[model samples]
Target: MAKIVDYGAFADRLKAAPNRWDVLREFHEEWGYAVRPGSDRWDRWTEDEHETYVRALSGEPRDEDGLEGVDLALPIPAALDEWWELPFNSFTHDSQHYETNPVYPPTVRPDPSGYGVAGPLQDDSDLVAPDADRRVCVFMAENQYCNEWGYLAAEAHDPDPRVLVSVDDDRWALQARSVSEFFLQLTVQRLPRTLGWSAEIYDGEEIIDGDEDDLRARITERMPELGFEPWAELQQDTIVYGGPDVLAFVADGELGGIAFAGRTPRAVLDLAERLGVKLTEEDLTEPGEY
Candidate 1:
């Protein structure tokens, strides 16, 4: 049987959360973890094993796999500090060869930390903010498929600063008003499509065979209370919706996929029930998480 999370209980917990970190922790505990292939990582490494591996990868002495101590060239946001500490988050600088990250940029690594992390956006950053030169960038996370996401140095001390996304390292804009909102937006939008067990309503699996435009239109008609917001300004028609307990999204125009997720198996399945979409618990054969 698919595990179902109690919507009422989860909603209550979210409202009662003391702060944003608590909300993130709530998802961490519920979302669980997925160990990508070849990522046994910290537990498998002896004290010096990871150190030696980093040194070998960089061709110089280094101590950390990710951005533990590397100078981001600006003050680190408190929310980012907390994000790095989350034990359950799968996003991190584990094996540079295995995972996606900020170091993907070609020009930024002249000062190679060797862990495949990018240095501060120096020199060419005049393209983004010519007047605010001191307000550079400190990229926290990125992936090969998605544009890079980070924060401005000007808002570094603000605990939860606004998020910035770039088409390239230099073409930047506000992705979210605050870090907490950004994480919520990212989680709600991403879970439905990427989670291994999720059903693709329009494209990919073609499980629903619904027209992309119609699927989006009907969803909007049914859940008028839940409004869609831009997932990224550059990714047209890719929008996201979040509720106290449920989250849903529509992807880029070509795929036009619709996905829904909640705290547990039952929670997401209820989306089918509410939307009158046809799906069964048993249909969730693949495991959850990335």
Candidate 2:
């Protein structure tokens, strides 16, 4: 039967294996894109450039593939601290051949120093006395079928008392039967469905405990503004939960899609203004550092 796993206990097991890396390399060999070597953007082109690259990838008609015309670049180290503010726990897509898109920050090479392990709480006194009142951030984002794996990770990692979520408007279902179709898939496709989200907290699969419903109720009660409704009756809905922080949201015809950034509305607006980002639903794409 399906059940929640303790993230801490199973953390080490989650590290990528050498064979997994090889598989990713092969994937890149078959479907990789060209990248401009030495470029920090990882030589990845903008969303608009995907079609042009895919057409060439299919050998339908186009330009280069080698270092001169490389399609995608290999994964580079990302910094962990950079993602501290991101609500949902984040992971770099580890498709050996090419690095995953939507690259996360604090890009750094994995070190024995503990890339995924939890550290001490900032306040030692708090550790001596757990506070009943504290909050965490939950980040939410939209994804297609393939990214369900990444979405799963986002739900499992961050562990704070307070949970907040950022959303990527729904854009999962799309047609990509043909090799050329994958290009079109890159474009956001709003589907007429919504997802019921949830999460759990634990040290590992063995010691796992905590109900997503209870967590949701607690967060909503603390915030008192979002007025999130309970979904005990909505059993048929597909529920996603777990990660660094708990995340729960719905994406449907009525909800459209939402991408989460792990920040408060006030922080989001402040950063946007400082960065000259306008406050619109579309601005949800970059929900700020967290």
**Predicted candidate 2 versus true structure: per-residue lDDT over 1-290, tens digit per residue:** 02322212212322332322232232222222223344232223445466765564466755442222121222211212223222211122221222223322111111123321111222322312464222111121223212210111221233211111111222122122221112112211110011111111221232122443443444334322211111111111122221221132323233222222222333334323432324543333331121
Instruction: Score candidate 1 by TM-score against the native.
Output: 0.60
Candidate 1: the clashing residue pairs are 4-266
Model 2 worst lDDT window (10 residues)? 187-196
lDDT of each: 0.51, 0.24
Cα TM-score per model: 0.60, 0.19
**Residue 10 Cα positional deviation in candidate 1, in Å, after optimal superposition:** 9.1
RMSD of each: 7.2, 21.2
